[model samples]
Target: MADTQTYKFNVGMTCGGCSNAVNRALTKLDGVSKVDISLETQIVEVQATIPQADVLEAIKKTGKPVTPL
Candidate 1:
């Protein structure tokens, strides 16, 4: 089995809908196992086996700017 990895991103999530958007986008990717977003902190924590670039692209699809942290 592939080792799961966690990545953190500073995103612009202001509410539950924004968080849910991020979750939905990332969860659709094949290797993504989990997605956690904190609207208060504007942080997105993703646990997956996919490449970081792929994850970043998924987040960008939400129309939110994301910075790796």
Candidate 2:
């Protein structure tokens, strides 16, 4: 089995819907094992076997700006 990685990002999320969208987007991606999002801080932490770039791409699909942390 592949080792899981944790990727953290600062996303431009202003509300619950935005956070939910990001959560859904990441959760749908293969290899993604977990997703934790904070709307107030606009922080997202994803645990997966995928690369950080792939995680970034998934979050970007939500149309939200993302900065790696």
Among all candidates shown, the one with the greatest TM-score: 2
For candidate 2, list the clashing residue pairs, or say none: none
How does residue 52 of candidate 1 score in lDDT?
89
Query: Each model's TM-score, in the order given?
Result: 0.93, 0.97
- Compared with the true structure, the alpha-carbon lDDT of candidate 1 equals 0.92
Q: Please provide, for model 1 over 1-69, each residue's C-alpha lDDT reduced to its tens digit, 9 standing for 90 to 100.
A: 788999999999888898999999998999999888888999999999988899999999999989999
Candidate 2 per-residue lDDT, tens place, 1-69, comes to 999999999999988899999999998999999899988888999999989999999899999999999
Q: What is the lDDT of residue 33 in candidate 2?
A: 96
In model 1, residue pairs whose N, Cα or C atoms come closer than 3 Å (at least 3 residues apart or on different chains), thus clashing, are none
Q: How many clashing residue pairs appear in each of the predictions shown?
A: 0, 0
Q: Candidate 2's C-alpha lDDT?
A: 0.93
